[model samples]
Target: MENVEQEFLSVIREYERVIYKVCYLYTTPNATLNDLYQEVVLNIWKAFPKFRRECKISTWIYRIALNTCISFIRKEKNIPEIVTLTQEADRSEEDDETQAMLQQLYRMINRLGQLEKSIILLYLEEKSYEDISEITGLTVTNVATKLNRIKDKLKKMNKED
Candidate 1:
């Protein structure tokens, strides 16, 4: 394989979980997971050659993944308003109660708007506010404010559930 191809593959392998999680969270009934995943990889590959060492690779990849999914949804007129994420990534070994709780959480998350969902996902990934801001192109203060609002929204959702 060419050096660039090899490097791209390496980066994708290293960040596959991030890519998959983003795709998984954005999948809708019309936009299947595999379809979204393939489109994201394709986008990353197309832009790999032009990617300079300006920002963190993870941030770039996250941007591409999110943009790809969001654009695909927009093209398909799908905003991913449904929550059908499977127990395929992790926590498959959790007890039934834990799994149920997780499903409920996913359902609530799926109800959020695209930006809100993205912020919450990054927060759950343990990304710092700075990192989230970098990936999301939001100011640190905006990320913090939105995060607090998202948390309150989630809490309200849980209470109403």
Candidate 2:
């Protein structure tokens, strides 16, 4: 039990940034990212004993974090007007152009329904189709199909912009 606690602590410390980033990406205006982060941490603590080290620590953490975030997003009933990143924080001249692109991309992602947004966020995080499948409990082919459709939709949105 002590070992598992230590392992979970180490894993959380190592992957805290990934967790925060995922929360920032998937949560909406009405969603409290901090609240979601706490939920994910509590979940990890609760599930830590079940950890068998069946995969890389990173992959395991990703699975837990993604599942927690997805489940929270799905259950939260009140959807608020989508908040743009610029509205959350001001851009600086020192900010990388890459960030600006991601801000625009997130705006489009916010337009997607809950499940699609989760899929797209995982895809953009450079998760493999197989990894996404495992985390999402969808087949690889389904992940691919959804990703292709999402790409098409984003492309169309870009064309309209």
Candidate with maximal lDDT? 1
CA-lDDT, candidates in order? 0.88, 0.77
Q: What is the lDDT of residue 49 in candidate 2?
A: 83
The residue-by-residue lDDT of candidate 1 on 9-44, one tens digit each, is 999999998999999888887788889999999999
**Model 2: what TM-score?**
0.83
Which residue runs of candidate 1 sit more than 4 Å off their true CA positions? 78-81
Candidate whose TM-score is highest: 1
Each prediction's RMSD to truth: 1.5, 2.9
In model 2, the clashing pairs are none
Off by over 4 Å in 2: 86-97
Per-model TM-score, in order, reads 0.93, 0.83
Cα-lDDT of candidate 1: 0.88
lDDT, residue 79, candidate 1: 43
Question: What clash count goes with each model?
Answer: 0, 0
